[model samples]
Target: MRPSLTPVPLGVEPMTRSILFEGLFVHGLPRNEAFEAELRQAGFDRGDLLPQYPLRLFRQCMDIACRHFYPGLPVEEGRRKLGHHFVQGFTRTVLGGAVAVGMPLIGPVRFLKKFPEHLRFDTSPILVQAVEVGERSFRMEFRTGVGLSPHFLRGMLEEGLRMTRVNPTLRVVRHSPISFDLHITW
Candidate 1:
């Protein structure tokens, strides 16, 4: 469980003495319902084997991850595949676990979206700069302000990354955006 402190809004100046970053990949997303209804109406079966969550609450992290890995795919097609794969994965896992995996799945899903997984970079503000050298990565900025503590700052920086899952043939990484101005062309 995350400690009792509140998280700073993203893009706001951070309130810590140092900064860090981490990389992540995610899985086990639940499907949302509105999309399910839409899918059924469109003649796509909301397969009994792969029941999904409501659309407004759907966790499309894996979908976003796909777009990152396969950058050239059309957005709409990627979106569809993402939804399909999410349901397949979600169903397969839960079915394997059987009744034991009941309601608790939702708890973590809801919690993570509200809060997020964190990944930290090397913990030093002085070495940081905004540069964009990689595709799908962005230059993010942070500053130490009020409510700043070494531990909390570290946690905040690490949020939003999910790197623990070990199955599936996909990969995702969330590193800090490279500094575009720091030229190192070889």
Candidate 2:
């Protein structure tokens, strides 16, 4: 069984962009009544999600998606697959046009250097720090408490770099309640 979510602090409500949900539902998962009902149980109404959603809800939604779509897989593996699909789904959406066009031109090295800034462009109120450790590698540290699995991040980074025509290898070097580090090399 997967561990429960860390409780959000009182009076601090972090939110996520609805575009993320749009990517998940429209591109990653089949949109059906069953999926919609599952989202509702996780405190989201698929049809009603609009400009933004609670960050907690987003995490729960991702977990639910992983469970539904990868029931036979381990939790970590399922979330990783979900993350990989999320990038594919996200880039196909109209809102993700910039990513589709910009990533190829930027290349993996440059893209990794600017990942933190680029992330802010799409998702706000989350803190990520990217440091270039070598010419062909970098370390991304999640500074704020995102609570996202490192395996999931690995999949996302792998797919994002793959879009630039390079395959990236990623691993979790450090993990804690408030932060985590992913070392990525192409």
Candidate of highest lDDT = 2
Q: On a 0 to 1 TM-score scale, where does candidate 1 land against the true structure? A: 0.21
Mind sharing the TM-score for model 2? Answer: 0.85
Q: Where does candidate 2 have its weakest 10-residue lDDT segment?
A: 118-127
Candidate 2 lDDT, 55-125, residue by residue in tens: 67777887888777888999878877877887888887886766788888889987787777756423324
Q: What is the C-alpha lDDT of each candidate?
A: 0.30, 0.75
TM-score of each: 0.21, 0.85
**What is the alpha-carbon lDDT of model 2 when measured against the actual structure?**
0.75
Q: List ranges where model 2 is wrong by over 4 Å.
A: 1-9, 121-125
Encode model 1's per-residue lDDT on 99-155: one tens digit a residue. Answer: 224424433233223322222221212232333344323333232212112222222
Q: lDDT at 139 for candidate 2?
A: 87
